[model samples]
Target: MYVPVSLLFFFIGTALFVYYKTQPGLLPETVTGDQVFPYFIVNGLPAGFTGLLIAAIFAAGMSTVSTSINSSATVVLTDFFNVTSHSEADEKRKMNILHATSVILGALGVGVGLAMMSVKSALDAWWSMAAIFSGGMLGLFFLGYIARGIKGSYAFVGVICGVLLIAWMSLSRQTVFHNYLTIVLGTLVIFTVGMLLAIAGSRLKKGN
Candidate 1:
């Protein structure tokens, strides 16, 4: 259900996007790929519908931003400040700290968003960054699920290799792999390397 729904959603979206992009005079040459959809929504749609869509977009954005800020604040307080170890009376102090952290993080998030406005394509930039950063975690996930008898040290080595591969793929113009494939390749690399090392280790142990 989920897969089919997602496929349908993307299929329809891509088709409409392509139509809009290829249709001449609908969008100016100066309008970027990222700006095209919003521009269309505002200009093409009826007034009431346009307002509703804009409101929906704002609601989604606000929800996501709030969640991120809250999560970040929780991490900062729990991990760095050790707020959880505080006394019951200090709950007020913790609340104050959390509020302050959330405000600071939210401000930082706004700054980053403003900075990213200059980027050509927000979607492309996001995917590239996601691919680069997801490598280590995705590799670890694969190792945990697929690579039997693999020790943490060997897994760490595999993750390092995977991260390097992903980084090179993302940063180097010479790399053949696409940005979308980075996490896939990185996870496979980590799992494969870790499994091979584990097998070799076991073989050596048996021989010894």
Candidate 2:
């Protein structure tokens, strides 16, 4: 799946690049990344093909949304609910919670989609938002996976520090780092501080 998807994107990107290079006048001067595919379809493709492309795009979006909702529901059910509880009542309650979670997530997704309608550049906005949201999360995951001695307390501190750093970078008007580097910076800060704190605590414990 991954390989095929990667190759598909590669070919599509190559085609887009070649098209832009050969026919630079086709795109408007103020056009954005998000508008490229739609612009191409509207201007280049025949009416029948355009409809098909639009339908395919809609189907892909629906597929992604359904998959996300299902995954979210499953995670909420499995992680929060007591799977060991075999009673029918417990099962019903868990099922209720799962459905509720799915509904809430779907609503949130809709809200976000509406909000993004106001954004000028969807691609940039998405990348920036993803970085902000996943920065601390991915940091903690990497720290836990790579570092052997990091305890929960150290991890907690690291998460706090990472969140604070990302917040500062995001909110500061004079920030020097590019938007794309935000996640990388946050992950590094968390892992480095978490590991150092863990090592220090270990040494202090041995000395004591």
Candidate 3:
């Protein structure tokens, strides 16, 4: 990340970030957002740096929206339809359904994002709330991954627990941990509950 030392520090900082992001995902989730943005801004960056930051912000939002739409649509098409479509003749129909789903979801995300802008900006507690409930999701994957016992019917129970855990964490106003840590704690709790359910399921199966 060294530069000619002759160039302004702002330019050097910009160069270094572009170089860094090019190399794998650089630091963990926290550091990645931090280092580059601050370095360029505090050092009195050029106009281009401001442009880049704005672009990066919008790009992040767009990518998030796109991914959400695509994922939701995929779940509806694959899991929901795969259950009942049992014939070769239905494959073509399913493909059409998937195409329709993708378009509809994409449109919905754009529409909702625009519509919700008023709500998003009006709230002061959004960032705190963001951190408070951030970690509920990682729990689902943890149970669905390491603990082989959690599967099938018991999986839904675990998911419900994850949602409830987030709700409890958010409403309690107990911001003991930062947003990132909140996610880890929430995930851990949900994973434990899910595992217990899976274990009980195993016991019932063995008794039967």
Question: Model 2: per-residue lDDT, tens digit, 96-145?
Answer: 98889999999999899999999887756765666666679988999999
Residue range 1-208, candidate 1, lDDT tens digits: 8589779857866976787767867877787677777887888889999999999989988998899889989898788788556555378888998999998998888887898989897767776777777768977887888765578888988888888888888878897877677788888888888888888888998999
Off by over 4 Å in 3: 1-75, 89-95, 119-137, 141-146, 167-181, 199-208
Worst lDDT 10-window in candidate 2 = 80-89
Per-candidate RMSD, Å: 3.7, 3.4, 10.4
Could you tell me how far off, in angstroms, the CA of residue 78 lies in candidate 2 after the best superposition? Answer: 1.8
My TM-score estimates for the predictions, one after another, are: 0.75, 0.78, 0.48
Report the Cα lDDT for residue 146, model 3: 84
- Residue by residue across 1-208, what tens digits does model 3's lDDT show? 3355435655755777776667645534554433555554544468887779778878987897778767887798768877766755366777788779988888876785686566533232464455445555677777777887567566667666666666665556675665445566677777887788888878999999
The lDDT, on a scale of 0 to 1, for candidate 2 is 0.83
lDDT of each: 0.81, 0.83, 0.66
Against the true structure, whose lDDT is highest?
2
lDDT (C-alpha) at residue 131 in model 1 = 77
Q: Cα deviation of 170 in candidate 3 (Å)? A: 4.5
